[model samples]
Target: MGELARALTRHGIRVRVVAAHSPGLPVYGKIGDIEIVRPRYWWPERLEMLRREVGGLPVVWRKYPLARVQILSFFLMHAFVTARYAQSCDVVHAQWTLSAGAACLGRWVHRCPVLVTVYGSDILQVPRHPIGAWLTWLVLSCCDRITAVSHALQKRVVQLGVSPERVLVVPIGVDVTKFLPADDVHRENLILFVGSLIERKGVRYLLEAMPQILSVFPEYRLVIAGDGPEIISLKQRAVELGISRQVDFVGFQSQDNVRVLMQRARVVVLPSLEEGMGAVLVEAMACGTPVVASRVDGIQDVVTEEVGVLVSPANPMELAEGIRTVLFDPIRWREYSYNARLRAVKYYNWDIIVPRFIQIYQSLVG
Candidate 1:
């Protein structure tokens, strides 16, 4: 969204972004001529209400009923706010599937063109739920244009009945300046993983592979960054495997912190079963850190042999072996690290990506 917003702004278009209230507000605020409207929520009050309702329900009933209500409320509230804010815009550009649903409703009421971008899970995972699937179809059919982050996602959108001509592939761009390599290589005994602690992210696989990794390289330490619902379980698993001492769970780090962490580490790892474009992989590459990722759709597109090592998803043995290969061979590591930076500058940087988005927006609104 930041990339597209900046791209459009550069082309003499005033861009307004509506996002959830959280981190990264200041970054958006600094973008000249762009208006950012973040929806605010009274977290304490909301949490109290949620707690009251949740306490009354039986465990079985609490799962689906409460989940459905919360989701519905979020969609309705976002739709209401987005419609009001998007009234003056010529086109509504939505970033995700839920946002697309909100945009679809907003466009319907205001009679504006709606463009929805699908970035993996929004098309693949969301559509599996009955309500989400219905909303997915509605947004796909109503949108003026459907942009996907990858060709794989474009195909998924088309399979969901969106027109082939309306769908465009526009991968997210990396900020070359913020993510470039450190001035000097300070070799450290660190292996870093930066992403959500979800099962699909294959965090469990990383933890499972720890024993093997430690057996061969006892001095090597694994740094797990980012937090999610599965953190507790992951921690428990690490303890059960007797590798908790070797794992460092560094909660969530800022972009600057992540870049620094990537620069200091020997290699970065992402073992996701599925991904949109794996933006962090490029970020690691941009920082001159060799990556070991799954050979899944989005990861495959990003982590070529030239830049990083690709292994089968959810296979602990393969993941461990791949990490070993990169860590043991300094010659191979140096070559991959060099190529990774080159790939980031050539293909994945914001300069290249932003222009492509500008072309899309110009073609749509001109």
Candidate 2:
């Protein structure tokens, strides 16, 4: 969002980010040239973003009645807040499909166009819930326009009975300048995985493959970054597999630290069973790091023979082989590194991606 806001600002499109964060008085701020208005939602605001980020105390909201009430209350609150702020805006660009549901209500209040962007799991995983499918379909049906972060997600939107013409594929871009390779530092034999520690992320398969990886490249170490419900289970799995000493569960690091890790690793792996676009792959690529990922969803969109290798999801032997193949051949390693950087700069940079968004906005407004 920071990248998108800055890019829109750069294109002379004034952007005011409306964010929902933890409890506090509504705060207004600037990130670069863009203005931001963060209006706290509902009372207490302690449970703000609980559905999105798994950061709250497990409460009764997970139950149907309480959860539905919260959702309805939030829709009313969000719509009211958004309508007033978006009064002068040409279009309201909501981040997630669920947010799009709120934005759709806000649009009815304000009489403005709404463009909803799907960032992977929102479209891919949300529909699996009993009520989520109908809500997703309703939101997609209500939007003036829909932009998915990848072709895979766009296809999913179409599957939800949306016309092929209504959904556009606008891939998420990374800050190439910040994620660039550090030539002065020596890269290590670190197999880095940066994402939420969840089942869908396929971190288990990567952990499963670690013993084989360590068998061939004994010096190699696995670094699992990010946090989630499965952290303890994953740790226990590592210990059971006897690779506890070889794996590092660094919880969740700051973005700068992640960049540093990306620069230091020999190969970055995201063995996701499902993904939106796997933005981490592009970030690693931007840092001139080769990737070994599953041939699923948007990971397949970005990774190719030139930049990285893709294997079947949940297959440890195949993943281990792909990683080993990338690691063993220095000639291919050099090629992969060079191509990774090139691919990131060519396609995944914000400067290139933001214009595509502006185009969508223009078409919608017209």
Candidate 3:
């Protein structure tokens, strides 16, 4: 959201980010030319702060009636306040179904067109429930324009009864200059995985592939980055597989650290069961690293033979083979690396993507 705000501002459009008030952030702040506001949603600010940190609302939602009321209260307050504030805006652009649900109500007041962007789980998980389905459809039916980050998501929105004409596929782009290839390649025999250590990411399958990967080349090491609910279980799995020593768990690193790791690895692997667009894959490619990812959903759209190898999801042997294909052969690695960087620079750079967004905003605001 921060990146989008900054990008929009750079293109000469002002953006105000209205979101839940977290513990550390100020109620109001500024980033570049963008304004950020986080209004209070509940009483006893400390409890709200704790809920933001540890997901306290969900804990109480299962048993407490007041917690259920708080959820509705939060949503209602957000919708009312957002519409009130957005009355003077040219357009209301909301990202994800929940935010769209809130922003869609702006039509009742300001009568501005709302651009609802469906990304990943909002379109995937939200529509599966009865209430969530109604809420999502309410936003989709009310919004003036709709955008998704992937073709897969665009199709899903259409399946949900949204008109095809209202939808656009405008992927989130990477900063090519910030994540550019290294001046000199010092890549090790390392296979890097950057994402939350969750089951959906297929991290366990990747760990299962390690023994076979190590058998081919003893020097090869696996570095898993990112923190999530599955991190502890993943560590236990590594120990059970007896490849714990070869695997390094560097929990959640910054984007800059990720860029360095991508450039320094022989291959970046993502064996996800599902994906929206796999922006992480593009980021790795931008750093001149070849990918070994699953051929599932939108991940297939990003990885190709020119940049990386694609294997079926949940197949450790195939993933191991794909990793071997990149890391074991220096000639092929160089070729894939060159092609990856070329593709990233040519297509997925922010320089190329921001203009597309500008065009969309102009058409809507006009």
For lDDT, the strongest prediction is: 2
Model 3, residue 318: C-alpha shift (Å): 1.2
Q: Model 3 Cα RMSD, Å?
A: 2.8
Evaluate residue 332 in candidate 1 and report its C-alpha lDDT on the 0 to 100 scale: 91
Clashing pairs in 3: none
Clashes of each: 0, 0, 0
Q: lDDT per model, in order?
A: 0.79, 0.84, 0.82
Model 1 agreement with the true structure over 1-366: per-residue lDDT tens digits: 675677667657788888754333332353478888765432433431222321112221234455445555556767877898788877788888777788777666766777788787778777777876777888789888888887778887888888899998877787888787875547588999998776678999998987898898899999999876678899999999999999999998888899899989888999999887898898899999999999887676788899878999999999999999998878998899999999988988777877776677667778
Task: Please give, for residues 179-199, the per-residue lDDT of candidate 2 as tens digits.
Answer: 998683579979999988877
TM-score of 3: 0.92
Greater-lDDT candidate between 1 and 2: 2
lDDT digits (tens) for residues 1-366 of candidate 3: 666777677777878888777655677888767888787777776655324312123234544566666676677777987888788887888877766778876568967778887767777766788887777777798888999988899898888888999999988788888887875547777889998765678999999999999998999899998876678899999999999999999988998899999888888999999888888899999999999999987787789899999999999999999988888777888899899999999988877887887787779888
Checking candidate 1 for backbone clashes, the offending pairs are none
Against the hidden true structure, what lDDT does model 2 obtain?
0.84
Question: Which 10-residue window in model 1 sums to the lowest lDDT?
Answer: 48-57
